[model samples]
Target: MSDAATKSDAAMKPGWTPRSAWAGILSEGSFGAKGPAGVTATAREDLGIASLIAPEDGEAALSQVVKTRFGLDLPTTPRTVVLAGRALVWAGPGQWLLVTENRTGFASDLQALSGLAAIADQSDGRAVLTLSGGKIRTALAKGCMIDLHPSAFPVGSAALTSIAHIGVHLWRADNGPNGAVFEFMVARSMAGSFWSWFSASAAEFGYSVHVGRG
Candidate 1:
């Protein structure tokens, strides 16, 4: 082994070690044996509609509005939920998702409510980047601005925030036994730039870039 490799191995003998193991795993080139190790990009244009009010009033409004607008009954319990629509995914507890679709005209329907709640048309303000691989979260921790531990953010949960200094919405994908994967919705204008930075941060972790279908 080269001097550097020897030293690297020696250092890892104890609890102290470099991130080379993680690096190698990400650099591997096997198909489904291990999916490519890299950051993949996808977009979810989320039209976030949230109803904030006193507990009693909000509860009644949520029940009535959800049934009237989407013909679905709201959950009685207080918890975060997601309602999947043909073009949109409605996240409960006063949250909804017009996922990966535009909501240019959806605002009109919301405006008709007249102070019943607050509606935010965030279609033009967000995009998504889906990062998948066994080492995905480990790679992300190198620069992510939020705590991504499963204990903190379980599956089917999401956080509206930023990574690598760019605004984004992050959620864990439920694509059946795929290990750990994350889908990030970032701003369209920042997509290209964030990709460059995200890829570089992932280099030491062995990233193989690809076009992902969500």
Candidate 2:
């Protein structure tokens, strides 16, 4: 191999770590309207993310593989399910985004389904953020057209929506003591633009940001 290739490989080996998409954009701290913060956005880059796509002819088989491997069924519609610390969020007709915390070999594990479907590593291709607080819904309502009311987009609901013209895969992870905790998955390239819309929307009340280990 060329010297350049060898150096590039070594630089990104073991000790090397990926940087957060929110670096410089989101710092760990409280900001905005001063008083008690009404919203909090946590950058969850520590989470491992991957894309699962089933071939039209292999959808059924792939679902079985997933269930056997992860002990969870893939959602048929826009929804999310957590089983064994992993979240399978429906992305489309035959696609789901798998998310987990502290699972470094996430994508490799998903490879077990490769015989039935395609698995793409999205740990670096996507930016994951968890937004929650008393004003979380209101803040999300500013740009999300879909109704976020519990009666509609209840906990475990997932949707492929747009925020400020940017495409985002959103899911209601859980109902926190204060309110629903929502997670937003967006393309890495659009992270900055999304943050701008998010921060501005939550500024009316107050928001805090906690950067994660990306």
Candidate 3:
């Protein structure tokens, strides 16, 4: 181990191991997995409180809103949903999805808009994390209380579930290679505890932890 690795290991709490490989990736983005070329990974984070509630028109409404507010024309069949600078995917019914970016500027847009929708700022209520690697599914199985096998969950699908007793927004990534990357969104208060639980479960798989911007 390098000097820094040695020191990190020494300072780590019991049952915890420091991961160095992902240090750089975390610092670059909010949540998403870094992987070898052609491999897939899922990443997730909170979309600060810039909530947009559109009506049954679905993508049409979303496109119109994007054009009118941001002058951006959204794609019709976007596998990833982007709103207020945050990207999200559907987690369950009721037109709900998980946002994976910090909602820094979303509040103002929602406030000045009027349409067939509702908007709420939920920036303070959530936290996010990214999971990736060839063994991601195996790693997640350690704590997730769901049948997350590809046949069941499938790519491009998302679900609201629990991990270590905390509610999470779980989404499968579309570009995942070998089906191994995923993103998770959780409540802010549960961040530390969930990390602890996730790290513990990942130990046997040679898991490592990286703390930084991503």
Which residue pairs in model 2 clash with each other?
A: none
Instruction: Report the candidate with higher lDDT, 1 versus 3.
Output: 3
CA lDDT, candidate 2, residue 22: 73
* Tens-place lDDT digits, model 2, residues 1-214: 9999999999888886667777767787888899988998989867778888888888889878778888989899999999877888999999998888756777567767667777887887888898999998898898899899999989999999898999999999877777789988889899999999999999988998886553
Report the lDDT tens digits of candidate 3 across residue range 1-214. 7999998988885775643333233333223233332222222333443345566766576666656766544433323444445554543332444343554555655655446355555565555565666667777887897777878866656677888888887766654435445667666667667767776565555543444242
CA deviation > 4 Å runs, candidate 2 = 1-17, 212-214
Candidate 1, which segments miss by more than 4 Å at Cα? Answer: 1-39, 43-59, 71-80, 86-115, 175-177, 208-214
lDDT ranking, best first: 2, 3, 1
TM-score of each: 0.55, 0.89, 0.58
Candidate 1 lDDT over residue span 25-55, tens digit each = 1222322224454443333333443333324
RMSD (Cα, Å) for all candidates, in order, is 17.6, 3.5, 12.3
Give me the displacement of residue 156 in model 3, in angstroms.
Answer: 1.8
**Model 1, C-alpha of 180: deviation from truth (Å):** 2.3
Worst 10 residues of 3 by lDDT: 37-46
**How many steric overlaps does candidate 3 have?**
10
lDDT (C-alpha, whole model) for all candidates: 0.53, 0.85, 0.55
* Candidate 1 C-alpha error for residue 35, in Å: 9.5
TM-score comparison, 2 vs 3, better candidate? 2
Candidate 3 lDDT at 196 equals 70
